[model samples]
Target: MIFIDYLENVELISCGFDHNFSITNKGEIYSWGLNSCGQLGLGDERNRNTPCLVSFPNDDLIDIRIKDIVAGNYHSIFLFENGQLWGFGSNRDGELGLGDKNNRSNLTKIPIENVQKIACSKFHLFSLAHDGSSYYAWGSTKYGNWLSSRKLDGQPASFSAASAMILESPITFGLTSKIKVFQFQEPISTKSIIRLFNNPDNYDVKFVIGDRRILACKCYLKSVSDYYCLMFSGAWKEKVEVEIRDYSYETYYAYLRMLHYGCIGINQNRITQLIDLATCYIDKRLMKHCKTFIRDDLDEQTMPTYLPLVIKYEIKELYDKLSHITIEQVLPKVTDSILQNNENSIEFLDWFYNQRRPFIPK
Candidate 1:
């Protein structure tokens, strides 16, 4: 039963690539297997033939109503009810960030409070707290830099032998005074973000710093509907005029909810009709996420396989990041010997460099 659970209360189960698993119910975290580098918090360097309890200090006062669990390449993390975090199994590279390289013999308490989410990486962890702040990287290289730069912690990301580029965390421009929060997931349009500051549609767009008291009612909506409500998002010093028809409202609401939750509650038969009717405006972030989900999750044979074609149809904010460069970098290194008096060969590099600057007319 080395890989099988013998624990009676093991109500849920999940296993990962390295044959590691985190099993729990209330708030308790348990694991077994491949303790070679101490990925299992079972103390000794021996592998357990069955699951064992990975205890927490607060276990005495709580039933371990753990909110969530995730596994990485050689590590694991779980969220708790008290907003605290707990992790064990693999402390190498300080991914466990207890400020030590020693294996955490059992479930060790990570004093990160008010955590709303625990994002586990191959050897590191990411914790997003309730106050809209984030914490991460008690493990691994790439995840650490990504997490550090996420909080605007100032260390520029470094290129490593592992050769992966971590994306920057979303940046928030500090507000001078009280104002509304405008948030959007990835599929959102560049147009919407700009609309918050100034509407290009030729209308006078403005916000007022009223009462000097910030109204911190933050709402980050997923679908197009919440953005729809943004028509009333401005600070009003006078009466406002807005018009939204019934069909538009229902369609936006349904599309918005679907994009947010990965589920739509609208009538199944009318979904096609809704998609067809709601063509005028769409949240760009929603459209992108849908395309990504389709590409990654769907098989390659899927006709509308947006995932496989994502890189092809991708729009890069910085064109250099459009794709990994092989020939572009290598071509510069190629000597004139390879170009030996061939006029056609000389023209090739000129055309290639010009191609790299994507702004010009193709």
Candidate 2:
């Protein structure tokens, strides 16, 4: 194992496939390892076995305090505390966000400002705006084409058909509305509460899903959900084992986990089912979480699939928000064959067409 003894008070470190970079608490950046692509940002293509300080151009007036750093396969991006962004290294794919496909050995300032955070892959870069809503992306257009589907400044996003050309500069996308940040209430003690979840030792009830049986606590379940409170109080109080139907084991377990641990492990695949369960149980917290995911992360590709759910579940907030989407904007992303295969997608298309019919000219 290599030990970096010379550096002190290291605040952050990011590594690429062959190179690495570290930032000190005093805002000093040190880099080492491979330099074949100048990812070291040391102003030369020389590999370093020891850490070397990365310097900025003398003309820069802002202080060089880095808030975050990310190293791509052949590039490095730095986000400054004052919201300025800088990058270096390979530009063959335009990952540097410099508006040109020229490699830079030294740090170069990116044109866009008010950057709060940055993330990168092998040949692309993504930056989050200071407002925590809009996202800016650059680098390979192969992946960046997703941005073309979104409406920018109330206008449909347009892009060239040429896939060979890279997105040399950052382009903004995602929801225009300010993102709603949800703060989950901290549990009294996470470890102990989490231990009680699915633990057979002191479980008073067992919910059977298919052939599998899941252990749970009655008192804790009752405390978190009114459905559990009502079920455990009346004629069903003596029930020790209950058979669950309709929902899968994973979805049910995630629901129980939320009630016990105050959070759920959710993804796109399971979000729809979880939302249905939340709606059936009248769980406002889970409903809000589901709505937030749809509202903030909704894109043209997913709008077709999710629009039906938004309407079916009566998610007024998202329904109203998605009403702005035009049929022309989403129809191109989905073909008639794909739509015919899905009844929900067909339903959404019909509903969306009628909603926009008044605006379309005869």
Prediction 2 TM-score vs. true:
0.48
| Candidate 2 lDDT tens digits, 1-362 | 13233665454566665777776656788899889878888999999988899887786634657666777777887877778878888877566767677888988887777765455654334222232334455665545533211212322222211112234544332211211223245532266776777997879899999999889888887887898899899745999998989789988987887666554545556778888998888898888878877775565536776888888987788765565554454444455646567876777789879998777576
lDDT of 1 by residue, 192-262 (tens): 34233223343332222231111111132312354434544543213232333434444444454343333
TM-score of each: 0.37, 0.48
Q: What local lDDT score does residue 65 receive in model 1, on the 0 to 100 scale?
A: 73
Clashes of 1: 18
Separately for all candidates shown, the number of backbone clashes (residues 3 or more apart, or on different chains) is 18, 0
Q: Report the error of model 2 at residue 200, Å.
A: 2.2
